[model samples]
Target: MIGRRILLAAGVLFGAAAFAQAQIDNGLPGPQPLDAGSMILNRTLFEGIMDRNSKVRSASAKPMPAGGYLSYRASSKVRQKVTREYLARAEKAYGKPIAEGLRKTLGAIDFVATWRRLATRDGLRTGDLGDSVTAYWAVNWLVANGKENSAPGQMQALRRQLGPLMASNPGVRRMSEAARQEVAESLMLDTVVLAIGADTAVQKNDPAVLAKLRTTTNDRFKQAFGIDLTTVTLTNRGLAKR
Candidate 1:
């Protein structure tokens, strides 16, 4: 009985020592690294860091799909190449030191749509460029032959792009009227080109989509610029609207 009692005592001591050693070796840290700043900083810095990180992620993220095209990301190099091309073409087209609002308008073409078009039809290799110029050259084209209310979506898309400058833009709220009008005027040139330049072989290949694209652009142009494109006559001993 004494021997058994001694064995029990020894076992208890052994377990107690083992547990103590484990407690020393396997103890969790009471204060984590992030916890050091969490008290006074309250994580806002961390949250902002996360938010900024997300933007970095998003700049190259796979974009949403549009039309019948597969979506892809044009690499930084390709985007930079296109930007250089755009700047060069734009400089040739509209002289040096491009106006801020006009540059903004041109640069805001749907990247997702642009990338998709490049990938699908333009033969853009992975992370390489197709015709980057065409991406922003005209995002959604408007058929000149269509009715006034025909191309609502195209106009809407243009209007949406135009909005940032229109009162910062019109959809958001009213801001500087003069500045807004100035920006709108700058955007109008693109509108005019689209009105005259929308007929394409690809567009004709898909007639139904082309039709919707037509109607959508018509109403949207009117809605966007308050200018009925169908009625623009280029007056002054002017050209006739054929």
Candidate 2:
């Protein structure tokens, strides 16, 4: 009976893998010629990191208020170690720059996961919107730049994979429409930033294109979010110089 049960479980696992591969072969959506193998490997690595973080967080939970702060610190250390190991493996598999982008992208995924957990464990608060916006920005930057140059179809695959993860998190559904709009606008701004950043050669040769992108992004942000991204950019640059 045990042998039969083991065989049944193996078959289920095989079937699931086959179904995922079939999805890749069919090219569900967004970009073409997907690197399914790399996607699978990266997804596995990403999931492992998230799983380790969750486990560490659960293990470090304390009953006392003072112990709670200590537990948070301990969990953070474990998360950092897990992130480093996975990121290093990613860098080895993919080049440094691409891996750096993936680090931000996957980190965004983890952030969303954590937010979702927090919202569920405790009721949603206004502060959650800020965290969600930040995650959306990082994801947008990686996805937009990735679609244009680095690992084109792979980002789409990653995004697709992330959908189910997000859907499973109840907090996402509870977010207000206005907060969601802020997240969307943040993503749009980041997309523009990446497009401008990626065109190093063009920027060096023309210089005008960079100005054009800046103007365009500024206008778009103003129209969409009613905020001045140009001023924000300039202010950030000024601070960096100092």
Candidate 3:
């Protein structure tokens, strides 16, 4: 079910730098203060924590223990680099006008609203970022149509449009090719998880399709986070609760 997928993905992100921000953004409401060790506990939110852990364990150098959210001081540096690199690349590839638009517009708001707003805006309708703008349109479409669980093809279409669009931006491309790689990686994971959940919910309520996808849907929980699906809970039950 969509609910299960959201839980699993959310669980997978439990301890990353953006996890707390995501939690609040997802409507959890209110911040829960974290003690120092609590940050370490969040390492599972990230996959490379193990690599950090191995280094900490074997080397005489004492790096912070892994497995916490943004607690690794390194992530702060990494995130800044990403934003700066992307901005610089975007500025160069897109030119001053479009780059400023992206920074002032796209960067200013949350993802969902940004996409939807772009789709409706006249000024954003044109430019080097057109493909990215269209990609967001597609995202908003899939989400609004409730085909969130449709298939990979939907996401593929968005990728197809946005990938080249992103590439076309010299500023964005100036950063190593890895910048696009990172965005694609994170987006793919996020989309697949959410789509699976939406698709599950749709199929779940359908008698015939439900039977076929029930097992597949059940396993999506683990597929998303590697954790038992039953253990995690969602406050919103998959959809934004009314």
Every candidate's lDDT: 0.29, 0.31, 0.31
Where is model 1 poorest over a 10-residue stretch in terms of lDDT? Answer: 1-10
Q: Which tens-of-lDDT digit does each residue in 1-242 have in candidate 3?
A: 11112232332332221322222123211111112112112324322433333334232222222112111121334334444554455455445654454344324433333332323232222122223323333432343333333232233333332333334444454533343333422232233323333444453375544333333433432343243323322111111111
Which has the higher TM-score value, candidate number 1 or candidate number 3?
3
Off by over 4 Å in 1: 1-73, 97-100, 106-141, 147-242
Error of 1 at 11 (Å): 81
**What's the CA error at residue 16 for candidate 2, in Å?**
46
Model 2 lDDT per residue over 1-242, tens place: 00000111233333222322222233212110112122123434444534443334232232112111111111444345445654565456445764466465444445323333322222222223232332332232222222222122222222233333333434544434443333333332233223323333132455554344345434433343333433221111110011
Off-target runs (Cα >4 Å) in candidate 3 are: 1-140, 148-164, 203-242
In terms of TM-score, how similar is model 2 to the real structure?
A: 0.27
Candidate 1 C-alpha lDDT tens digits along 144-225: 3343222212222222222222212123143233322222222222232232223331223666544554555545534433
- Candidates' TM-scores? 0.23, 0.27, 0.27
**Which residue runs of candidate 2 sit more than 4 Å off their true CA positions?**
1-45, 49-152, 200-202, 205-242
